[model samples]
Target: MIATTSLQRMIGALAALLAAVGSASAHPHVFAEARLDVVLSADHQSVKALRHLWRFDELFSSTVLMQFDKNSDLKLDDAELKDVADTIFSSLAEYDYFQLVTVDGKDVHMNAPSQVMTNFDNDQLIVLFESEPATPIKLAGTIDFGVYDPTFYTAIDFTEDANMAVEGLPSTCTRKVIRPDPDTAIAQNQKTLTDAFFNDPTGTDMSKIFATKLELTCKP
Candidate 1:
């Protein structure tokens, strides 16, 4: 049986010790490369679901894999994979899987992930899951979505343009990555607010200044 509290604490440490950085910067202890697959309904006017893939950094991957490696095989088999998936699903509930989605500038509430799976690739751990909106969302003037750690404790990086994908969209749809520079806001308040800015364990509003945004446009 899994020790629920122990599992939560261990996974929670991902935010405090996954990455090596300077003391001057208290942000981003965990780093992950992620991808987004937006699934549209057959009509091409409604979003049905979102499929996500996240590959964890080496330090974090090694720790998680070791914990889930039953039988000391240094690998996870079917049973082990299910165990890891369950643990992740339970732990991530608190973070909402770090996903933010919007349609026409309005925030969309997502249902809990319907599926979660675990895998190993090139010595790193990968997690995949699919989630849908509370209700299917109709395509409006524009849609915006992203995978992120709102608390800034985890740095989710979408490495390239190809990491963002749209499926079932009409040929007229186009997407773009909008990377904003928040240095000015951070710098202006650094001296007086540095402690509160980086030390907020929950990450609160800090993500607004750093989260990468993906925008989609489709011809009406």
Candidate 2:
């Protein structure tokens, strides 16, 4: 990678973290633990935005640090972390920042991240961002808010250590995590997928079968 500027280095790092899978089928080339905070409108009748936190796996974190640690320091400094966050916020625009949102079976348009923050801890690279809906989604019927890599190059999972929460939700509302089992999802939906689906930069929405989702439902 011939990076002549700091911006180039940051972009290079983002590319490294987003390296595609080479498999004939979609497979994970990178991994991360994820958390989400779903914020509701002040009226509690609509969704405002989804705040995300993703802590990348050790191997990919090291690869990212290698690209951004320009000062020869062993660890990522505050400035380096900020650059990394900026890279993610910009580069991931095409990926919808890995967020998939829907209401009553209708797709919810998500705007680009409004803010980004980064932290490096215990040899991991963590990114935080908030993405707002193009328009507030009314609290009606079922809502599916999820995190997935459309290309399946990165497997973002929600583990017990992390949480998926809804803030300012109406007392009548309920929320649940819809974390799918990969093996089961593959068996059920792999037939609908093709090489083109896995390789396409702007792929179809076939990744929902294996996503870690937050399901929010409100009573009529």
* TM-score, model 1 to reference: 0.80
Runs in model 1 lying further than 4 Å from the true structure = 1-25, 184-202
The per-prediction CA RMSD against the true structure, in angstroms, equals 4.5, 4.0
- Candidate 2 Cα errors over 4 Å, as ranges: 1-25, 183-191, 194-204
Q: Model 1 — which ten-residue stretch has the worst lDDT? A: 16-25
lDDT of each: 0.74, 0.75
Candidate 1: residue 130 Cα off by (Å) = 0.6
Local accuracy of candidate 2 as per-residue lDDT tens digits, 38-134: 8888888988888898898898788778878889788888898887877777767777787889888778899987778888889998888888999
Q: Give, for candidate 2, the lowest lDDT window spanning 10 residues.
A: 9-18
